[model samples]
Target: MTAAILLQLVLNGLAMGIIYSLPALGISLIWNASGLFNFAQGDLLTLGGYVMLSLFGKAGLPYIPSFIMTVAVMGIIGYALSQAYFYPMLEHRVNPQIILIGTVAFSVFIRNLVLVIWGTTPQTYKNPFGSSVLQIGELYLMPHVIWIVAIVAVLLITLQYFLRGTMVGTAMRAVAQRPTASYLMGIRNDRMIALTFMLSTAIAAVSGVLISPIIPLTPSMGGIIAVKAMAAVLIGGLGSFSGALLGGVAVGIAETLFAAFVSSTYRDIFIFGVLVLFLLFRPGGIFRASVSEKV
Candidate 1:
Protein backbone atom coordinates (compact mmCIF):
# COMPACT_ATOMS: atom_id res chain seq x y z
CA MET A 1 0.00 0.00 0.00
CA THR A 2 1.06 3.61 -0.54
CA ALA A 3 2.27 5.74 2.37
CA ALA A 4 -0.95 7.72 2.69
CA ILE A 5 -3.03 4.58 2.33
CA LEU A 6 -0.95 2.85 4.99
CA LEU A 7 -1.30 5.81 7.31
CA GLN A 8 -5.05 5.97 6.85
CA LEU A 9 -5.41 2.25 7.46
CA VAL A 10 -3.39 2.47 10.66
CA LEU A 11 -5.41 5.45 11.90
CA ASN A 12 -8.68 3.76 11.03
CA GLY A 13 -7.58 0.61 12.82
CA LEU A 14 -6.66 2.61 15.89
CA ALA A 15 -10.07 4.26 15.87
CA MET A 16 -11.76 0.89 15.52
CA GLY A 17 -9.66 -0.39 18.40
CA ILE A 18 -10.82 2.52 20.53
CA ILE A 19 -14.40 1.62 19.60
CA TYR A 20 -13.83 -2.00 20.62
CA SER A 21 -12.08 -1.03 23.83
CA LEU A 22 -15.05 0.93 25.21
CA PRO A 23 -17.25 -2.14 25.49
CA ALA A 24 -14.32 -4.35 26.35
CA LEU A 25 -13.57 -2.13 29.31
CA GLY A 26 -17.18 -2.48 30.41
CA ILE A 27 -16.94 -6.26 30.04
CA SER A 28 -13.74 -6.28 32.05
CA LEU A 29 -15.32 -4.09 34.71
CA ILE A 30 -18.37 -6.31 35.12
CA TRP A 31 -16.23 -9.42 35.14
CA ASN A 32 -13.77 -8.08 37.67
CA ALA A 33 -16.23 -6.42 40.04
CA SER A 34 -18.99 -9.02 40.07
CA GLY A 35 -17.56 -12.03 38.25
CA LEU A 36 -20.51 -11.71 35.90
CA PHE A 37 -19.81 -12.44 32.25
CA ASN A 38 -22.09 -9.98 30.48
CA PHE A 39 -22.91 -11.50 27.12
CA ALA A 40 -25.32 -8.69 26.29
CA GLN A 41 -22.77 -5.91 26.58
CA GLY A 42 -22.56 -5.51 22.81
CA ASP A 43 -26.31 -5.28 22.52
CA LEU A 44 -26.14 -2.39 24.93
CA LEU A 45 -24.04 -0.60 22.33
CA THR A 46 -26.69 -1.29 19.71
CA LEU A 47 -29.34 -0.10 22.12
CA GLY A 48 -27.55 3.21 22.59
CA GLY A 49 -27.42 3.81 18.83
CA TYR A 50 -31.10 3.18 18.34
CA VAL A 51 -31.96 5.31 21.32
CA MET A 52 -29.93 8.17 19.86
CA LEU A 53 -31.58 7.71 16.50
CA SER A 54 -34.99 7.81 18.09
CA LEU A 55 -34.25 11.02 19.91
CA PHE A 56 -32.27 12.77 17.21
CA GLY A 57 -33.79 11.56 13.97
CA LYS A 58 -37.36 10.91 15.00
CA ALA A 59 -37.90 13.33 17.86
CA GLY A 60 -35.99 16.07 16.06
CA LEU A 61 -34.09 17.05 19.14
CA PRO A 62 -30.83 18.92 18.88
CA TYR A 63 -27.55 16.99 18.91
CA ILE A 64 -26.35 17.77 22.43
CA PRO A 65 -29.78 17.29 23.96
CA SER A 66 -30.28 13.98 22.17
CA PHE A 67 -26.88 12.72 23.25
CA ILE A 68 -27.48 13.65 26.88
CA MET A 69 -30.83 11.89 26.75
CA THR A 70 -29.22 8.83 25.23
CA VAL A 71 -26.68 8.59 28.03
CA ALA A 72 -29.33 8.85 30.72
CA VAL A 73 -31.52 6.17 29.14
CA MET A 74 -28.63 3.79 28.45
CA GLY A 75 -27.34 4.12 32.02
CA ILE A 76 -30.70 3.10 33.41
CA ILE A 77 -30.94 0.13 31.07
CA GLY A 78 -27.44 -1.04 32.00
CA TYR A 79 -28.14 -0.86 35.70
CA ALA A 80 -31.48 -2.59 35.27
CA LEU A 81 -29.92 -5.40 33.31
CA SER A 82 -27.37 -5.94 36.03
CA GLN A 83 -29.98 -5.88 38.79
CA ALA A 84 -32.39 -8.19 37.01
CA TYR A 85 -30.04 -10.73 35.53
CA PHE A 86 -26.80 -10.55 37.50
CA TYR A 87 -27.84 -9.44 40.95
CA PRO A 88 -30.48 -12.10 41.42
CA MET A 89 -28.26 -14.89 40.23
CA LEU A 90 -25.32 -13.78 42.36
CA GLU A 91 -27.54 -13.29 45.40
CA HIS A 92 -28.91 -16.81 45.13
CA ARG A 93 -25.45 -18.31 44.75
CA VAL A 94 -26.34 -19.77 41.38
CA ASN A 95 -23.81 -21.78 39.42
CA PRO A 96 -21.40 -19.71 37.36
CA GLN A 97 -22.37 -21.73 34.31
CA ILE A 98 -26.01 -20.86 34.91
CA ILE A 99 -25.16 -17.20 35.24
CA LEU A 100 -23.31 -17.41 31.96
CA ILE A 101 -26.36 -18.92 30.32
CA GLY A 102 -28.58 -16.27 31.85
CA THR A 103 -26.44 -13.57 30.29
CA VAL A 104 -26.58 -15.32 26.94
CA ALA A 105 -30.36 -15.44 27.21
CA PHE A 106 -30.38 -11.76 28.07
CA SER A 107 -28.26 -11.08 25.02
CA VAL A 108 -30.72 -12.90 22.80
CA PHE A 109 -33.60 -11.07 24.40
CA ILE A 110 -32.10 -7.63 23.78
CA ARG A 111 -31.23 -8.37 20.16
CA ASN A 112 -34.69 -9.73 19.43
CA LEU A 113 -36.28 -6.86 21.29
CA VAL A 114 -34.42 -4.41 19.07
CA LEU A 115 -35.54 -6.29 15.99
CA VAL A 116 -39.11 -6.03 17.14
CA ILE A 117 -38.97 -2.37 18.04
CA TRP A 118 -36.69 -1.13 15.27
CA GLY A 119 -38.00 -3.67 12.70
CA THR A 120 -34.65 -5.03 11.46
CA THR A 121 -34.22 -2.08 9.14
CA PRO A 122 -30.68 -0.70 9.20
CA GLN A 123 -30.62 2.80 10.73
CA THR A 124 -28.09 5.58 10.70
CA TYR A 125 -27.61 8.46 13.08
CA LYS A 126 -27.26 12.12 12.10
CA ASN A 127 -23.65 12.81 11.34
CA PRO A 128 -22.35 15.36 13.79
CA PHE A 129 -19.19 15.99 11.77
CA GLY A 130 -20.90 16.88 8.49
CA SER A 131 -18.35 15.41 6.05
CA SER A 132 -15.41 17.05 7.77
CA VAL A 133 -11.94 15.63 7.12
CA LEU A 134 -8.64 16.70 8.55
CA GLN A 135 -5.89 17.12 5.99
CA ILE A 136 -2.53 16.04 7.41
CA GLY A 137 0.16 16.24 4.75
CA GLU A 138 -0.73 13.45 2.29
CA LEU A 139 -2.96 11.63 4.78
CA TYR A 140 -6.56 12.76 5.18
CA LEU A 141 -8.21 11.79 8.44
CA MET A 142 -11.92 11.56 9.11
CA PRO A 143 -13.10 13.92 11.84
CA HIS A 144 -14.93 11.08 13.51
CA VAL A 145 -11.61 9.34 13.95
CA ILE A 146 -10.05 12.35 15.61
CA TRP A 147 -13.10 12.66 17.84
CA ILE A 148 -13.01 8.99 18.80
CA VAL A 149 -9.32 9.08 19.64
CA ALA A 150 -9.64 12.28 21.64
CA ILE A 151 -12.65 11.03 23.53
CA VAL A 152 -10.96 7.74 24.36
CA ALA A 153 -7.88 9.57 25.57
CA VAL A 154 -9.90 11.83 27.81
CA LEU A 155 -11.88 8.87 29.09
CA LEU A 156 -8.74 6.92 29.94
CA ILE A 157 -7.27 9.87 31.80
CA THR A 158 -10.50 10.57 33.62
CA LEU A 159 -10.86 6.92 34.57
CA GLN A 160 -7.28 6.75 35.79
CA TYR A 161 -7.85 9.77 37.96
CA PHE A 162 -11.10 8.42 39.28
CA LEU A 163 -9.65 5.06 40.18
CA ARG A 164 -6.65 6.65 41.83
CA GLY A 165 -8.17 9.68 43.49
CA THR A 166 -11.81 9.01 44.30
CA MET A 167 -13.17 7.05 47.23
CA VAL A 168 -15.75 5.10 45.24
CA GLY A 169 -13.22 4.30 42.54
CA THR A 170 -10.78 2.93 45.09
CA ALA A 171 -13.58 0.98 46.70
CA MET A 172 -14.53 -0.52 43.37
CA ARG A 173 -10.92 -1.47 42.75
CA ALA A 174 -10.78 -3.06 46.18
CA VAL A 175 -13.95 -4.97 45.43
CA ALA A 176 -12.43 -6.23 42.23
CA GLN A 177 -9.31 -7.19 44.08
CA ARG A 178 -10.98 -8.88 47.03
CA PRO A 179 -14.72 -8.76 47.48
CA THR A 180 -14.70 -10.42 50.86
CA ALA A 181 -12.04 -8.10 52.17
CA SER A 182 -13.81 -5.05 50.78
CA TYR A 183 -16.92 -6.15 52.60
CA LEU A 184 -14.97 -6.51 55.79
CA MET A 185 -13.74 -2.96 55.28
CA GLY A 186 -17.37 -1.81 55.30
CA ILE A 187 -17.58 -1.19 51.58
CA ARG A 188 -20.91 -2.19 50.13
CA ASN A 189 -19.66 -4.65 47.58
CA ASP A 190 -23.04 -5.16 46.00
CA ARG A 191 -23.66 -1.46 45.57
CA MET A 192 -20.24 -0.92 44.08
CA ILE A 193 -20.84 -3.77 41.67
CA ALA A 194 -24.09 -2.20 40.56
CA LEU A 195 -22.39 1.13 40.08
CA THR A 196 -19.78 -0.54 37.96
CA PHE A 197 -22.51 -1.82 35.70
CA MET A 198 -23.93 1.68 35.28
CA LEU A 199 -20.54 3.18 34.56
CA SER A 200 -19.60 0.50 32.11
CA THR A 201 -22.90 0.78 30.32
CA ALA A 202 -22.52 4.53 29.95
CA ILE A 203 -19.09 3.99 28.47
CA ALA A 204 -20.52 1.53 25.98
CA ALA A 205 -23.19 4.03 25.08
CA VAL A 206 -20.60 6.70 24.42
CA SER A 207 -18.91 4.32 22.05
CA GLY A 208 -22.14 3.66 20.24
CA VAL A 209 -22.84 7.36 19.80
CA LEU A 210 -19.37 7.96 18.43
CA ILE A 211 -19.51 5.07 15.98
CA SER A 212 -23.13 5.15 14.78
CA PRO A 213 -22.54 7.88 12.20
CA ILE A 214 -19.78 5.84 10.61
CA ILE A 215 -21.72 2.62 10.03
CA PRO A 216 -25.24 1.40 9.45
CA LEU A 217 -27.03 0.93 12.75
CA THR A 218 -28.74 -2.42 13.17
CA PRO A 219 -29.68 -4.72 16.00
CA SER A 220 -27.01 -7.21 15.00
CA MET A 221 -24.37 -4.58 14.31
CA GLY A 222 -22.81 -5.15 17.69
CA GLY A 223 -22.42 -8.90 17.18
CA ILE A 224 -18.99 -8.59 15.60
CA ILE A 225 -17.94 -5.96 18.12
CA ALA A 226 -18.96 -8.14 21.04
CA VAL A 227 -16.80 -10.94 19.75
CA LYS A 228 -13.90 -8.56 19.12
CA ALA A 229 -14.18 -6.99 22.57
CA MET A 230 -14.10 -10.42 24.18
CA ALA A 231 -10.90 -11.07 22.31
CA ALA A 232 -9.61 -7.67 23.46
CA VAL A 233 -10.38 -8.47 27.09
CA LEU A 234 -8.65 -11.84 26.75
CA ILE A 235 -5.66 -10.41 24.94
CA GLY A 236 -5.40 -7.40 27.29
CA GLY A 237 -5.65 -9.51 30.44
CA LEU A 238 -8.96 -10.18 32.08
CA GLY A 239 -8.88 -7.50 34.75
CA SER A 240 -6.40 -4.85 33.70
CA PHE A 241 -7.59 -1.55 32.22
CA SER A 242 -4.26 -0.71 30.61
CA GLY A 243 -4.14 -4.18 29.12
CA ALA A 244 -7.61 -3.80 27.67
CA LEU A 245 -6.63 -0.53 26.04
CA LEU A 246 -3.44 -1.94 24.58
CA GLY A 247 -5.09 -5.14 23.46
CA GLY A 248 -7.91 -3.24 21.76
CA VAL A 249 -5.54 -1.00 19.81
CA ALA A 250 -3.47 -4.02 18.89
CA VAL A 251 -6.50 -5.93 17.62
CA GLY A 252 -7.68 -2.93 15.59
CA ILE A 253 -4.28 -2.39 14.00
CA ALA A 254 -3.88 -6.05 13.20
CA GLU A 255 -7.27 -6.33 11.53
CA THR A 256 -6.76 -3.27 9.36
CA LEU A 257 -3.26 -4.26 8.24
CA PHE A 258 -4.38 -7.77 7.45
CA ALA A 259 -7.30 -6.57 5.38
CA ALA A 260 -5.07 -4.23 3.40
CA PHE A 261 -2.20 -6.66 2.80
CA VAL A 262 -4.10 -9.92 2.56
CA SER A 263 -7.73 -10.65 1.83
CA SER A 264 -10.51 -8.74 3.55
CA THR A 265 -12.42 -12.03 3.74
CA TYR A 266 -9.62 -13.65 5.73
CA ARG A 267 -9.20 -10.71 8.10
CA ASP A 268 -11.58 -12.14 10.69
CA ILE A 269 -9.92 -15.54 10.32
CA PHE A 270 -6.61 -13.91 11.17
CA ILE A 271 -8.16 -11.99 14.08
CA PHE A 272 -9.51 -15.13 15.70
CA GLY A 273 -6.32 -16.99 14.86
CA VAL A 274 -4.41 -14.48 16.96
CA LEU A 275 -6.87 -14.89 19.80
CA VAL A 276 -6.45 -18.68 19.73
CA LEU A 277 -2.69 -18.35 19.83
CA PHE A 278 -2.90 -15.97 22.77
CA LEU A 279 -5.18 -18.32 24.65
CA LEU A 280 -2.86 -21.24 24.03
CA PHE A 281 0.27 -19.42 25.08
CA ARG A 282 0.19 -16.22 27.12
CA PRO A 283 -3.28 -16.57 28.48
CA GLY A 284 -2.53 -14.03 31.19
CA GLY A 285 -2.27 -11.50 28.36
CA ILE A 286 0.47 -8.97 27.59
CA PHE A 287 0.20 -7.27 30.98
CA ARG A 288 -0.07 -9.91 33.66
CA ALA A 289 -1.68 -8.78 36.88
CA SER A 290 0.54 -8.71 39.91
CA VAL A 291 -0.08 -11.61 42.27
CA SER A 292 -1.89 -10.42 45.39
CA GLU A 293 0.34 -10.69 48.40
CA LYS A 294 -0.96 -12.42 51.51
CA VAL A 295 0.89 -11.79 54.71
Candidate 2:
Protein backbone atom coordinates (compact mmCIF):
# COMPACT_ATOMS: atom_id res chain seq x y z
CA MET A 1 0.00 0.00 0.00
CA THR A 2 2.90 2.34 0.83
CA ALA A 3 5.03 4.01 -1.90
CA ALA A 4 8.18 2.02 -1.00
CA ILE A 5 6.25 -1.26 -0.97
CA LEU A 6 4.80 -0.37 -4.38
CA LEU A 7 8.23 0.44 -5.81
CA GLN A 8 9.72 -2.85 -4.62
CA LEU A 9 6.82 -4.81 -6.08
CA VAL A 10 7.20 -3.00 -9.38
CA LEU A 11 10.92 -3.78 -9.45
CA ASN A 12 10.26 -7.45 -8.72
CA GLY A 13 7.65 -7.53 -11.46
CA LEU A 14 10.05 -5.96 -13.96
CA ALA A 15 12.62 -8.66 -13.22
CA MET A 16 10.10 -11.40 -13.83
CA GLY A 17 8.96 -9.59 -16.98
CA ILE A 18 12.49 -9.57 -18.35
CA ILE A 19 12.74 -13.30 -17.73
CA TYR A 20 9.48 -13.99 -19.57
CA SER A 21 10.35 -11.66 -22.45
CA LEU A 22 13.33 -13.74 -23.60
CA PRO A 23 11.37 -16.86 -24.42
CA ALA A 24 8.34 -14.91 -25.58
CA LEU A 25 10.48 -13.08 -28.10
CA GLY A 26 11.85 -16.39 -29.30
CA ILE A 27 8.36 -17.80 -29.70
CA SER A 28 7.22 -14.75 -31.61
CA LEU A 29 10.23 -14.80 -33.90
CA ILE A 30 9.99 -18.49 -34.77
CA TRP A 31 6.27 -18.31 -35.38
CA ASN A 32 6.49 -15.32 -37.69
CA ALA A 33 9.54 -16.45 -39.64
CA SER A 34 9.01 -20.21 -39.94
CA GLY A 35 5.22 -20.57 -39.71
CA LEU A 36 5.70 -23.39 -37.19
CA PHE A 37 5.07 -23.47 -33.49
CA ASN A 38 8.17 -24.60 -31.66
CA PHE A 39 6.54 -26.44 -28.81
CA ALA A 40 9.97 -27.42 -27.52
CA GLN A 41 11.30 -23.87 -27.26
CA GLY A 42 10.97 -23.86 -23.50
CA ASP A 43 12.81 -27.18 -23.22
CA LEU A 44 15.71 -25.31 -24.75
CA LEU A 45 15.56 -23.19 -21.60
CA THR A 46 15.77 -26.27 -19.39
CA LEU A 47 18.58 -27.69 -21.48
CA GLY A 48 20.57 -24.48 -21.12
CA GLY A 49 20.21 -24.53 -17.37
CA TYR A 50 21.39 -28.12 -17.08
CA VAL A 51 24.26 -27.47 -19.44
CA MET A 52 25.33 -24.52 -17.30
CA LEU A 53 24.90 -26.68 -14.22
CA SER A 54 27.36 -29.20 -15.62
CA LEU A 55 29.87 -26.54 -16.60
CA PHE A 56 29.72 -24.38 -13.48
CA GLY A 57 28.44 -26.64 -10.72
CA LYS A 58 30.17 -29.89 -11.68
CA ALA A 59 33.24 -28.92 -13.70
CA GLY A 60 33.97 -25.76 -11.68
CA LEU A 61 34.27 -23.68 -14.79
CA PRO A 62 34.15 -19.92 -14.41
CA TYR A 63 30.84 -18.14 -15.08
CA ILE A 64 31.80 -16.33 -18.30
CA PRO A 65 33.16 -19.43 -20.04
CA SER A 66 30.28 -21.55 -18.81
CA PHE A 67 27.66 -19.08 -20.02
CA ILE A 68 29.30 -18.72 -23.42
CA MET A 69 29.59 -22.49 -23.76
CA THR A 70 25.95 -23.02 -22.89
CA VAL A 71 24.73 -20.51 -25.49
CA ALA A 72 26.97 -22.02 -28.16
CA VAL A 73 25.77 -25.54 -27.42
CA MET A 74 22.13 -24.47 -27.42
CA GLY A 75 22.56 -22.68 -30.74
CA ILE A 76 24.00 -25.85 -32.25
CA ILE A 77 21.11 -27.88 -30.92
CA GLY A 78 18.66 -25.42 -32.44
CA TYR A 79 20.24 -25.69 -35.87
CA ALA A 80 20.30 -29.47 -35.54
CA LEU A 81 16.61 -29.55 -34.71
CA SER A 82 15.87 -27.62 -37.86
CA GLN A 83 18.10 -29.93 -39.91
CA ALA A 84 17.02 -33.23 -38.45
CA TYR A 85 13.34 -32.71 -37.80
CA PHE A 86 11.98 -29.64 -39.55
CA TYR A 87 14.00 -30.03 -42.72
CA PRO A 88 13.10 -33.68 -43.03
CA MET A 89 9.45 -32.88 -42.61
CA LEU A 90 9.65 -30.23 -45.30
CA GLU A 91 11.48 -32.59 -47.61
CA HIS A 92 8.79 -35.25 -47.25
CA ARG A 93 6.03 -32.66 -47.63
CA VAL A 94 4.62 -33.56 -44.26
CA ASN A 95 1.55 -31.71 -43.05
CA PRO A 96 2.15 -28.62 -40.93
CA GLN A 97 -0.08 -30.12 -38.24
CA ILE A 98 2.15 -33.18 -38.11
CA ILE A 99 5.22 -30.98 -37.79
CA LEU A 100 3.56 -29.19 -34.91
CA ILE A 101 2.94 -32.55 -33.30
CA GLY A 102 6.57 -33.39 -33.88
CA THR A 103 7.51 -30.33 -31.84
CA VAL A 104 5.27 -31.56 -29.02
CA ALA A 105 6.96 -34.95 -29.10
CA PHE A 106 10.32 -33.25 -29.14
CA SER A 107 9.35 -31.31 -26.03
CA VAL A 108 8.42 -34.48 -24.18
CA PHE A 109 11.59 -36.23 -25.30
CA ILE A 110 13.82 -33.38 -24.13
CA ARG A 111 12.17 -33.26 -20.72
CA ASN A 112 12.62 -36.99 -20.24
CA LEU A 113 16.15 -36.79 -21.55
CA VAL A 114 16.98 -34.24 -18.87
CA LEU A 115 15.24 -36.33 -16.25
CA VAL A 116 17.27 -39.37 -17.24
CA ILE A 117 20.61 -37.62 -17.46
CA TRP A 118 20.24 -35.37 -14.43
CA GLY A 119 17.87 -37.45 -12.31
CA THR A 120 14.72 -36.15 -10.65
CA THR A 121 16.53 -34.16 -8.01
CA PRO A 122 16.15 -30.40 -8.17
CA GLN A 123 19.47 -28.60 -8.64
CA THR A 124 20.35 -25.03 -7.84
CA TYR A 125 22.26 -22.77 -10.18
CA LYS A 126 24.84 -20.85 -8.14
CA ASN A 127 24.77 -17.12 -8.77
CA PRO A 128 28.06 -15.96 -10.17
CA PHE A 129 27.42 -12.60 -8.49
CA GLY A 130 27.39 -12.77 -4.74
CA SER A 131 24.23 -11.63 -2.97
CA SER A 132 24.57 -7.88 -2.79
CA VAL A 133 21.74 -5.48 -2.13
CA LEU A 134 21.50 -1.90 -3.24
CA GLN A 135 19.58 0.41 -0.98
CA ILE A 136 18.06 3.77 -1.91
CA GLY A 137 16.08 5.31 0.93
CA GLU A 138 13.70 2.53 2.08
CA LEU A 139 13.88 0.55 -1.19
CA TYR A 140 16.25 -2.41 -1.49
CA LEU A 141 17.23 -3.96 -4.84
CA MET A 142 19.11 -7.12 -5.72
CA PRO A 143 22.12 -6.85 -7.96
CA HIS A 144 20.90 -9.85 -9.93
CA VAL A 145 17.62 -8.08 -10.67
CA ILE A 146 19.48 -5.12 -12.12
CA TRP A 147 21.68 -7.47 -14.15
CA ILE A 148 18.64 -9.27 -15.56
CA VAL A 149 17.00 -6.07 -16.75
CA ALA A 150 20.21 -4.67 -18.21
CA ILE A 151 21.16 -7.89 -20.01
CA VAL A 152 17.74 -8.29 -21.62
CA ALA A 153 17.77 -4.64 -22.64
CA VAL A 154 21.12 -5.01 -24.37
CA LEU A 155 20.03 -8.19 -26.18
CA LEU A 156 16.77 -6.64 -27.33
CA ILE A 157 18.48 -3.54 -28.62
CA THR A 158 21.05 -5.65 -30.43
CA LEU A 159 18.27 -7.71 -31.96
CA GLN A 160 16.41 -4.60 -33.13
CA TYR A 161 19.55 -3.30 -34.79
CA PHE A 162 20.22 -6.66 -36.36
CA LEU A 163 16.74 -6.96 -37.80
CA ARG A 164 16.54 -3.40 -39.02
CA GLY A 165 20.13 -2.69 -39.97
CA THR A 166 21.78 -5.92 -41.15
CA MET A 167 21.40 -7.58 -44.53
CA VAL A 168 20.74 -11.02 -43.08
CA GLY A 169 18.17 -9.62 -40.70
CA THR A 170 16.34 -7.88 -43.53
CA ALA A 171 16.45 -11.09 -45.55
CA MET A 172 14.95 -12.98 -42.66
CA ARG A 173 12.21 -10.39 -42.44
CA ALA A 174 11.57 -10.85 -46.14
CA VAL A 175 11.22 -14.57 -45.65
CA ALA A 176 8.79 -13.98 -42.81
CA GLN A 177 6.75 -11.66 -44.93
CA ARG A 178 6.56 -13.91 -47.95
CA PRO A 179 8.60 -17.06 -48.25
CA THR A 180 7.66 -17.66 -51.87
CA ALA A 181 8.32 -14.07 -52.87
CA SER A 182 11.51 -14.03 -50.85
CA TYR A 183 12.62 -17.12 -52.74
CA LEU A 184 11.79 -15.34 -55.98
CA MET A 185 14.01 -12.52 -54.75
CA GLY A 186 16.88 -15.02 -54.34
CA ILE A 187 16.60 -15.45 -50.61
CA ARG A 188 17.41 -18.84 -49.15
CA ASN A 189 14.20 -19.53 -47.29
CA ASP A 190 15.33 -22.74 -45.67
CA ARG A 191 18.53 -21.20 -44.38
CA MET A 192 16.67 -18.25 -42.95
CA ILE A 193 14.33 -20.55 -41.04
CA ALA A 194 17.29 -22.46 -39.70
CA LEU A 195 18.93 -19.24 -38.64
CA THR A 196 15.70 -18.17 -36.95
CA PHE A 197 15.72 -21.38 -34.92
CA MET A 198 19.34 -20.90 -33.99
CA LEU A 199 18.82 -17.34 -32.87
CA SER A 200 15.61 -18.05 -30.97
CA THR A 201 17.13 -20.99 -29.13
CA ALA A 202 20.16 -18.95 -28.23
CA ILE A 203 17.86 -16.32 -26.79
CA ALA A 204 16.09 -19.00 -24.77
CA ALA A 205 19.45 -20.16 -23.50
CA VAL A 206 20.28 -16.68 -22.31
CA SER A 207 16.99 -16.57 -20.45
CA GLY A 208 17.75 -19.87 -18.78
CA VAL A 209 21.20 -18.83 -17.61
CA LEU A 210 19.97 -15.51 -16.28
CA ILE A 211 16.99 -16.85 -14.32
CA SER A 212 18.38 -20.19 -13.15
CA PRO A 213 19.80 -18.67 -10.00
CA ILE A 214 16.41 -17.39 -8.92
CA ILE A 215 14.37 -20.53 -9.58
CA PRO A 216 14.80 -24.19 -8.64
CA LEU A 217 16.17 -26.14 -11.60
CA THR A 218 14.44 -29.35 -12.59
CA PRO A 219 13.29 -31.00 -15.81
CA SER A 220 9.86 -29.48 -15.19
CA MET A 221 11.25 -26.01 -14.61
CA GLY A 222 10.75 -24.79 -18.18
CA GLY A 223 7.15 -25.95 -18.47
CA ILE A 224 5.55 -23.22 -16.39
CA ILE A 225 7.74 -20.52 -17.87
CA ALA A 226 6.96 -21.80 -21.35
CA VAL A 227 3.24 -21.57 -20.68
CA LYS A 228 3.59 -18.05 -19.36
CA ALA A 229 5.70 -17.04 -22.33
CA MET A 230 3.04 -18.36 -24.68
CA ALA A 231 0.48 -16.22 -22.95
CA ALA A 232 2.84 -13.29 -23.32
CA VAL A 233 3.07 -13.91 -27.05
CA LEU A 234 -0.70 -13.88 -27.27
CA ILE A 235 -1.05 -10.76 -25.19
CA GLY A 236 1.59 -9.00 -27.19
CA GLY A 237 0.92 -9.17 -30.92
CA LEU A 238 1.88 -12.64 -32.14
CA GLY A 239 4.29 -11.28 -34.71
CA SER A 240 5.16 -7.89 -33.25
CA PHE A 241 8.55 -7.40 -31.59
CA SER A 242 7.54 -4.32 -29.59
CA GLY A 243 4.30 -6.04 -28.71
CA ALA A 244 6.15 -8.93 -27.10
CA LEU A 245 8.19 -6.48 -25.06
CA LEU A 246 5.16 -4.62 -23.85
CA GLY A 247 3.10 -7.73 -23.22
CA GLY A 248 5.78 -9.46 -21.17
CA VAL A 249 6.41 -6.55 -18.83
CA ALA A 250 2.68 -5.91 -18.52
CA VAL A 251 1.94 -9.53 -17.60
CA GLY A 252 4.74 -9.61 -15.05
CA ILE A 253 3.55 -6.45 -13.38
CA ALA A 254 -0.09 -7.53 -13.39
CA GLU A 255 0.70 -10.91 -11.86
CA THR A 256 2.85 -9.41 -9.12
CA LEU A 257 0.28 -6.75 -8.29
CA PHE A 258 -2.50 -9.29 -8.19
CA ALA A 259 -0.52 -11.49 -5.84
CA ALA A 260 0.23 -8.54 -3.58
CA PHE A 261 -3.33 -7.21 -3.44
CA VAL A 262 -5.30 -10.39 -3.92
CA SER A 263 -4.47 -14.03 -3.23
CA SER A 264 -1.14 -15.46 -4.37
CA THR A 265 -3.13 -18.49 -5.52
CA TYR A 266 -5.05 -16.30 -7.97
CA ARG A 267 -2.01 -14.78 -9.61
CA ASP A 268 -2.11 -17.20 -12.55
CA ILE A 269 -5.85 -16.85 -12.78
CA PHE A 270 -5.51 -13.11 -13.13
CA ILE A 271 -2.81 -13.43 -15.75
CA PHE A 272 -4.76 -15.86 -17.91
CA GLY A 273 -7.94 -13.98 -17.28
CA VAL A 274 -6.33 -10.94 -18.94
CA LEU A 275 -5.19 -13.22 -21.77
CA VAL A 276 -8.75 -14.40 -22.37
CA LEU A 277 -10.04 -10.85 -22.45
CA PHE A 278 -7.40 -10.01 -25.02
CA LEU A 279 -8.27 -13.09 -27.06
CA LEU A 280 -11.89 -12.10 -27.22
CA PHE A 281 -11.55 -8.38 -27.71
CA ARG A 282 -8.16 -7.89 -29.36
CA PRO A 283 -6.77 -11.14 -30.69
CA GLY A 284 -4.41 -9.15 -32.91
CA GLY A 285 -2.60 -8.45 -29.60
CA ILE A 286 -1.56 -5.26 -27.93
CA PHE A 287 -0.08 -4.44 -31.31
CA ARG A 288 -2.49 -4.55 -34.20
CA ALA A 289 -0.06 -5.90 -36.78
CA SER A 290 -0.46 -9.11 -38.74
CA VAL A 291 2.20 -11.43 -40.12
CA SER A 292 2.08 -11.14 -43.88
CA GLU A 293 2.21 -14.33 -45.90
CA LYS A 294 2.03 -14.94 -49.63
CA VAL A 295 -0.85 -17.04 -50.79
Backbone clash count, each prediction separately: 0, 0
TM-score of each: 0.94, 0.95
Top TM-score prediction, candidate number: 2
TM-score, structure 1 vs. true: 0.94
Error of 2 at 108 (Å): 0.7
| Per-residue C-alpha lDDT of model 2 across residues 100-193, encoded as one tens digit per residue | 8998898899999999999989998667767778898999988888888988898899999999999999999999888889999999888888
Candidate 1: tens digits of C-alpha lDDT, residues 222-268: 89988998898889987788888888899999999999898999998
The lowest-lDDT stretch of 10 consecutive residues in candidate 1 is 286-295
Lowest lDDT sum, 10 consecutive residues, model 2, at 286-295
